[model samples]
Target: MKERFLRAGAAVLTAAALGAGLSACAPLVIGGGAMVGTLMAIDRRTAGTQVEDEGIELRAASRIRETLGDRAHINVTSYNRQVLLTGEVATAEDGQKAEQIVRGVENVLSVVNDLGIMPPSSLTQRSNDTFITGKVRASLVDAKDLTASAFKVVTERNVVYLMGRVTQREAKRSAEIARGVNGVRKVVRAFEVISEEELQRQLAQPAPVTQDPAAASAPARR
Candidate 1:
């Protein structure tokens, strides 16, 4: 296990370095790679804490997928002990089963099952989602304006969910990129920002704003 972790760590570091190189125009892919690398590193550093959490999350997701038996397409994301399940299932029972599986995971503090009861994933939707995720990742990788590692992207039914700790500007840029991705229906932000003091400090920096020429002329005329 220790040897395996060492290998994983090396791979993650390599990915992170590669991701940094691609961060300018492929922020999404870089962000995704960074997220994965961070998770792997955490698991390596605190093998007991994170490995257990990951095991539980993956086990639960696999069980739910198996139980659904080809009727559903589920994506599971685990963060800090929280599990988010998204995608579609064929029936309400299948959704419930998914919830149960995630809840049964030992270290899961909470489970947000955003599983919709719908038909299996269409080829078109799958293809579009793949493309969107790839592009968004690429954008994150290439974005110079924000820390690409501070956001997480999840796509379902063409809508993109952005989550993590980021400044308002970072969040806005992330949303903009997601919106610009072809076939994206919507962009949702679920971010936690820094304290008010930090936000104020950032806001104090110079920024360009449009001035109203008519108002200036009116004041001069008066």
Candidate 2:
């Protein structure tokens, strides 16, 4: 029964994500740190880097919010410790301050400041940003040589920010794919570029699988 249930759940997710170019991990039903563990199994970054990136995001966000208060609207996305800041701010000084604040975060390696000098974005624009991000991510999934799970896609004001550790070929291909998405105004590569050889080495090593206890002891679903 457990095997059948898991198989059915996987099938439903596969169907739902088809044509959307999302990671198979996106719709996973696993819980807690287990969810992070499962996704990390297929992620390109080392587990340490993933943990650091998460830390950088949280630290940067907290600092940004505390320092800027309600005067500015900022979005921070950290991948492999490289942060990307987007959205709107009241002044150029505020934008610079936001980036500086993120830079002070311990694990942050670098930052890309794309915040505009304007009032905060409306709900409609933010919603559209979400839609565009999904579309770009889906497009990356459709790309033949690109691995959707290997990259992080963030969209703000129609600009698509791509982050990950990828080879030059993969990064360029990913940018091209993102640019082709309907609502993407531009594609910005914030990747930690690697060699093709390194990419292949990681690809050849299969992800470690942790058996679901209930399913493992059960009969096969087929």
Candidate 3:
């Protein structure tokens, strides 16, 4: 799963770098498609975290929520189908309930429950989030060297969440474009990459590193 995510991330970054050099008018459509593709690829790779089990947890959670009513607030994030269930639930039982529900889903390798006991987001906040999401989407569509679809753009309090398969250069270009978008307070990137081989021995290996979410979330450009 990790290997797949790494590869997808590398591909996205490569695309982004390539997009960056493209002329503005030419990038309007292709960039957006590329971005979406990159994001989808990353999502697909992460779904393998359970070693082939994929999106099982997400499906389970959705079904559980539907059965239990909409009161249970849960956010499901899956990478290669390894599910991370975050957000708040009403009670300890609810948390366990979610885990059980997710576990029952086919292909779910594991579930990481980061849910807290809290209320759901207010309507106004949800509206704002939606607006931000739209803006980011539009910006990506309009920008050159950016694929609107290659990125998973999530907005929290005006801060953008960028997750996708991308190369280092593409990531940088994506960030710059996001920073230029209006109403974006910041951009957070949970991007992975493939590094150059080391010359230490006859056989070299890829260097591993955790992506810093904050690095991509810097304040919007002026």
Candidate 4:
């Protein structure tokens, strides 16, 4: 069991390394697909569901901007069709409004509104949050028994929010890893918990193959 998670994490280390180094950059991809295709391939969500999550984030963000404008500082992160709203709003009313907008988005199963009532966080503070996020991500990658790709880490005001489809063991283990990171004030989990049996079944499924660019460019056999 430990060996399986280690192997999976090792498979994506190169891509993850680049992502960690450029933690502040726009998301990096591997194998011409979103978010390091290898990671996505190993993700608990089906490829189609993963795509839907991205759509949910985009649509919800757009709607929030149209409705709230600069009145709030909101970050929308969707995993497994569930939306997590973090950051601050000018007022409690704005926070409630933001949640409603997200819930209205197509295919959003639920919303976890953690929006604070305050002015937008400063650039320096936001930068620190980004740094904290990267540190938490690195901590997860270093955990041998956990498949780092299976989790999504988000930070706001030094609080780390973790989202994923995982077994209870994974949920507990990952939260421990996140809390251990420096500058992480709190760890909030929004995991879709599954049984150990379901996890084993998922692990037994074949992982997607990543083709070598050189081989991909070569002509097919007759």
Whole-model Cα lDDT of every candidate shown, in order: 0.63, 0.74, 0.55, 0.81
Q: Using lDDT as the measure, which candidate wins?
A: 4
Candidate 3 residues 170-197, lDDT tens each? 5787788778877788786665443323
Q: What overall lDDT, based on C-alpha atoms, would model 3 receive against the true structure?
A: 0.55
lDDT of 1 by residue, 108-132 (tens): 8777778888876665665556556
Candidate closer to the true structure by lDDT (higher is better), 2 or 3 = 2
lDDT of 1: 0.63
In TM-score terms, which candidate is top?
Answer: 4
Error of 4 at 117 (Å): 0.4
Please state every model's RMSD to the true fold in angstroms. 18.0, 7.1, 14.6, 4.6
Q: Candidate 1: worst 10 consecutive residues by lDDT?
A: 24-33
TM-scores, in order shown?
Answer: 0.61, 0.78, 0.48, 0.81
State which candidate, 3 or 4, has the greater lDDT: 4
Candidates ranked, most accurate by lDDT first: 4, 2, 1, 3
lDDT of 4 by residue, 1-222 (tens): 544654455546544544543443233334543335555577788877887998898899889989999888888899999999998999999999999999999999999999999988876677777777767777777787887778888888999999998989999999999999988899999999999999889889987754455666779999
What does the lDDT read for residue 73 in candidate 4?
A: 80
